[model samples]
Target chain A: MIGEFSPGLILILGALLVPLLRGRLRAIYMLALPVAAFAHLTTLPHGDLGIIELSGVSLTTLRVDKLSLLFSYVFLVAALICVIYSLHLRDTVQHVAALIYAGSAMGAIFAGDLVTLFIYWEAIAIASVFLIWASRTEDSYRSGMRYLIIQVGSGVLLLAGVLIHYRQTGSLAFGALGLDTPGGLLIFLAFGIKSAFPVLHAWLPDAYPRGTPTGTVFLSAFTTKVAIYALARSFAGTDILIPIGTVMAAFPIFYAVIENDLRRVLAYSLNNQLGFMVVGIGLGTDLALNGAVAHAFADILFKGLLFMSMGAVLFRVGTIKGSELGGLYKSMPWTTGFCIVGAASISAFPLFSGFVTKSMIMTAAMEEGYFWIWIVLLFASAGVFHHAGIKIPYFAFFAHDSGKRCQEAPLNMLVAMAVAAALCIGIGSFPDFFYTLLPFETGYRPYTLDHVVAQVQLLFLSALAFTLLMRTGIYPPELRSVNIDAEWFYRRAGRSLADGARMAAENGWKSVTHGIGRTISVVIAYVQRHHGPEGLLARPWPAGTMALWTTLMLGACLILFYL
Target chain B: MSAHRDPKEKRYWLDDPANVTRLVRVFYVVCAALIAIDVFVPKHGPFAIEHWFGFYGFFGFLACVALVLIAKQLRKVLMRPEDYYDR
Candidate 1:
């Protein structure tokens, strides 16, 4: 009986009850839902449930497998953290949106068929946009619209791919669809867009920063991670993902470094981390696949931790701009500490979650004879440590004082951050507990002597370089500026194209009206000349003209008769 | 000046310029020591280039420096006022 129930349905249906409750009841209800779903997930055995046949097509609503279970476990954990973080808020809409978004992500992961996956895919898009809109800023509104369009566009492509695939293969199962077919290609692009692949990545950094403090935390955990799961499920072992992922991993660090907004920098860093998972999926070995999933699991915890810390700063100080924030560790020591933990975890320092997970992919690359790709990944690793580890903490906490005093984050926010930070450390210190949950069994050890020494040298020397650059003033100062990325083509070039079209339309209308006016005037002149009282037809000799016209007609008739 | 005096009296240890300078010096010494230890430790790098003394340290340092320099130039092309999009 317990196996028949869907964990995602618990959260989705549980969301409907949110508006009915008030005060502490609503808070308790919200917190219990994620826990309930998590418990439900633990009890269910790995098998399919809720299978339905519709018009000769089968839809699998609940499919319990190791991969789905792995993603669902992390999704629920993230939801619990987000719910606790947002407990102080009275925004019923955000609460509902967060639940539905989390539920839909779970639903997507558990979906057995492409049809079921498509439903949850679109559900995630519709539900998550509300978080951005919760900010109620005009900028957030616009950014939310842009996020919606891109997300929904991804959904449409997924639907298209699914339908084409169903027609072509006569089955709707969600599994490996290599690049040999159009449907598979469409599905890959859809996942690519959501995964924040280079050109299609702008919406993430653009919209994530615009969400409310707590809302951004929820937003960070689900969407792109879900896409990573989808990619791992369908496109594992695709060779193209290597270069695609390499580009994804490498390019964002440059943007992250020069970016002023701390939250936006985290967003870029998120994309960079996703690139590692994508590369792992490309490598397609048992170790690499496990690395991909394990990294995804760890990423949700640590990235959410990073976002939570920045959200706290934004909550207290009303800005996360690196230029405007400094020496905040004075006032918000706990939040600062948590932020550093997050930074260290993300930078893959020794004994951190990232070190254990990210290295597997690197090792896989090297073992598979991908010498150059491994080199790029290594360079990216150093670069990530540089921006996320050093830049975030240095600018926000340790640089010259900005003289802005603010209280530490609210109690609920701090508690939530502590929970996430604990998990980050817990996973880093005892990765075996996490490794057991991965999709495959492995004997990979992250703490080999060489890995430890090399990692330390990479990180410590990067820190040294940062110190030297800062002292020499060679490092670029954080300015109150936006560093343009791929979004520029759409936000700028696309807008310009729209403006040109509008101008052309306006000019075309003017010319059209002018031509119509000239033609109308010509017709009016002809009418006036012919129909006016003093015109030739109205002259006093009209009778004589009629007689001549009749005579000419009769002569023509006579000539016709003679012929 | 009176307002400044009270805040200055409440300054944390980390807020002191002397403390910060000392910490930075200590960090530099630690970095130098780590690099120096590379010479004494047994080389176990998988790649031949990695066996070079201080290779990781130099690579990390040069990578960071290059990233900063390249990013600085990128800023010249990509940086705009924060309200660039809003306008």
Candidate 2:
């Protein structure tokens, strides 16, 4: 029997048995994997449990701490919810992929050394791509390939950083790695890429919407949150991250405002939410860090809820494009209601999950004297509510009637969504219980009258602005269009650059080959001109002429030798 | 409630344009009332900016309007036909 193992190993190894079962048995088994892991995680003491020396270097496979434990619990919760959402899927590949993906994310969070984190990091990237490929569309295939390359590239950066850092520091410990050296900077970049740091963020919006509906819900939860956990562990209080987080918070809302794919809109919203957490980490106070981790927990559930609701709509209506979808509330009332809850939560309405967690970050920033940063964050908060909070449900479910009719989302889908929605409310209403799970101790209260009144005023007025903009026709309509983002550098400009390079190589080779052929032909012609039958050497000369020529050549040779 | 609607009435409550107008009117009152609470309720924050009456409300309103308007103009440069990547 096993004494102890990383809880993540359960899901990773259990995925192998998923194919052997069918239907309800498979669902039950899949659900049980996380449930068992969560129970095991709760029982495990906070210490390094699996340490073995490999080549004189001790590799730690399991390191349980408050931070890792918090992240692991959320990962398991997400895995269960996502599995429930996908219960109707007959596709075995998605089930296995999602299980392994979630497991790898959990593994990354608990890793005590860079090597362990790197292995699970790569595994997470490779396993999650199957979710995108499970869509089985040409677009999904190509998108998955790109996503795989960039994600694996991030792993490569992490591995390189780990090697360099080990050579310099003589250890592979995953601890506070400030950016004072090349290795540390490389590791930070790896985390930045995963966290969707501005320019590095293109892959997320590109690939996430391409995943199968249930697959996207799984996609939304794990990968980025792991990056946040890593960053919080290693790079907390780094000054550059504040600016980086600012841009990440600011720019995405603009893009989300015009993005047509509703799921893609959420992807942008996810980036904006990550920015909030990153800033919290940057502040690095107890309240800030606690706020960051807590906000991540809230984001996972509410963001998952939002994604699940849209997935339900996509499952029934067969379209998630905002241009083609509207007025779906009549046909799918429960989904619409759940979606509103998610919207309200994301908007940080009073007595919601977002309000409790986000307030900590904002308050922490102010306490830390990030005056301008706090101001910008306030603006970002309003913008987040405007785009994600208002635009998503407003455009998809209630803007105008696309006149599309369908059944409500399947029972399993509704159950999954309802569970997620309930959790969003539960965490919002009773955050005291949730606060116990935070890595840091705090006596912060979220229900202050001033804070509540301020938040409510901000949200309500944002809604009013939306209403006024719609009434005056200043608001852009949902349309069948695309917006160029940082991804434009790769998707269009990068493609053309590759094409141009190929064309240049082709022309260069053709010219070189043409010159070589021309020279060869010239040599051949010159040879034929003298040696062919019609040439002087080939002409039938008399024997006397040959003899005379030979005599002349002999005399010249004799003269030259004498000289 | 929707299931028990009259057969003669084809439109739901949300479908009526008048209800939406009244809702907007009520929304306006709600916004006004929310700001009015600032007078009676004590305000506290790290900075003096938080003490300004209806600061968040106005900031939220202006910020959202600016985002929309700026984003609308952004479309001029960033917007492409639906199949921009495919082509």
Candidate 3:
């Protein structure tokens, strides 16, 4: 029975107990829940578990396959890391929300049927918004509301698609439903919104930086990766994703470069990295699929590590703005070291985790004859190194000293970063460990002579360019400003439209009232003249007037008859 | 006066002007060394363009330059005060 139990439920139930526990016990309990789930995940065989029939439709709540198992492992690991990072906080609400968020993501991964998947999908959306709300700022509250609306909107689309899909085919099984059907396209767009596909991407950059420090670490790990998993599960090899993914990869780099909030820039970089995985899913070859999955795995660790380091900085310094931070390496050397590891991993430096995983996607692109996409990917790669690798560290730790000093990151935060950092290096050095966990087997090697040389050249030259630009003062300086993004159309134009509608309604109401007043006045004057004690009918000779009126009416009737 | 300076100020190595100069020089030297490696190794590229000396180097450098320039121009159109949304 324990073996058949859904690992996700274990964490979800554990979330309820968070309020009952005390300080050290609470930390231990939180950490132990993910470990238990991961252990349960490893013991299960590759078959459907937790089957229940609802209204004659079979709902499989747990599906133990390689893909599901791999994602669950990483999800649990990220949860553990986040729990450790947030151990200093006394906020029970955030702790509970983080657990539910991670658990629901894991549930969605193991969901064997569409209905079960939809349930978990909505759960993830609802649970994760609290992370944004935990910041307790008006901005965070507003952004969290926006995040909730968009996420729930995706869920509604998914529900509609599921209903339509079930009608088209009498099965609620979740599998590869291509874009040929209307339902399938709807499902694809739903996943696209969650995956941060270009126009649907604004929520990520908008809301991610608004989360509390520890909340962001959890936020960065789950939502988009779940979408990537869903896309890999359903829409693999869709040619449209190729171009869509290429734009996703390429456009974010420009925004990342100019973004002043260090965490927001990482969020943009996260979008860029997700692009590579999306492209791989489009390729849909064994190598490409493996690349996408492998990159997803690597991304969670590195991106989580990056977000953790920045979170620690935010916790200590009270701000993550690039313009407001510099020379923090003086006060926070361990964080600096870990941040560099994360930056290098994200930038795909050779002997780092990104190099081993990201190369698979590039190799997949070249092999599939997507030469132009490959070139754009290459440009994105270089651009990522410029902004994320060089700029995050350069501005935060090494640039002109902002003359602000703070205490080093707390011990719990340091321990979390160290663990994630070790994993990044471990996976990079031993790619075989991660490759074995991938859903597909591949003979691809990441450390081939040409691959290593090419990657090194690209990264080093990008670094060279950063150096030159900084010296020449050609690079844009970080300022205390916000860059308008796709969200602008809604935040600005949408408000204006609403305002215009409100003004029109007010004017229309005013005009209607004025017209009614004039009509009432005219009617009252006519009444006063005809029936009130004013004119004609109210005169003393009413009887004579009535007789004359009757005679005139009779004469007019006779005239009409004659005519 | 020196004693009145923040204790953390003395711990930062880059606070010294000499150390800053040395770090800059080291960065330039490393760049030069990386570029020099192009002369020694033969590139096994799939395209003819890759056969050009320092192709990746030039591309990386130019890409960064272009990204910054384009982003600078984009900022002219897109940048707003930090409280743009608040207002």
Q: What share of the reference contacts survives in each candidate?
A: 0.74, 0.87, 0.69
Candidate 2's C-alpha runs over 4 A off are: A515-563, B1-10
Q: Please give the DockQ score of every candidate, comma-separated.
A: 0.60, 0.55, 0.54
lDDT of each: 0.90, 0.92, 0.90
Question: Ranking by TM-score, best first?
Answer: 2, 1, 3
Tens digits of lDDT, candidate 3, A1-563: 44577889889999999999998999899989999888887788889888887878898888888888888888888999999999999999999999999999999999998899999999999999999999999999999999999999999999999999999988787888889888898999999999999999999999999999999999999999999999999988999999999999999999999999999999999999999999999999989988898889989999999999999989999999999999888889999999999999999988889999998888888888887998899999999999999999889987887776789999999999999999999999888878888988887788776667667778887887787788889889999999999998788888889889999999999999999999999999998989887677676776787799999999999999999
Q: lDDT tens digits, residues B2-86, model 3?
A: 3456775466566787997898789778767776777777766566666777777788888888888999899999899999988
On DockQ, the leading prediction is: 1
- Where is the poorest 10-residue window by lDDT in model 1 chain B? B1-10
Candidates arranged by lDDT, highest first: 2, 3, 1
Report per-prediction Cα RMSD to one decimal: 4.5, 4.7, 5.3
Q: What lDDT tens digits, residue by residue, belong to model 2 across residues A1-563? A: 15567889999999989999997788889989999999888788878878867989998888998899888888899999999999999999999999999999999998999999999999999999999999999999999999999999999999999999999999899999979988999999999999999999999999999999999999999999999999999999998888888888888999999989999999999999999999999888999999999999999999999999999999998999999998788889999999999999998997789999999999999988888999889989999999989999988888777767789999999998899889989989988999999998989999988888899999999999999999889899887898988889989999999889999999999999999999999998888888787776678889998899999999999999999
Total clashes for model 2 = 0
lDDT of 1 by residue, A216-310 (tens): 99999999999999999999999999999998999999999999999999999999999999999999999999999899998999999999999
Q: List the residue pairs that clash in candidate 1.
A: none
| Regions of model 1 farther than 4 Å from truth | A1-3, A513-563, B1-5, B39-45
| DockQ result, candidate 2 | 0.55
Candidate 3 TM-score, C-alpha based: 0.91
For every model shown, what is its TM-score relative to the native structure? 0.92, 0.92, 0.91
Q: Which 10 successive residues of model 3 chain B have the least lDDT summed?
A: B1-10
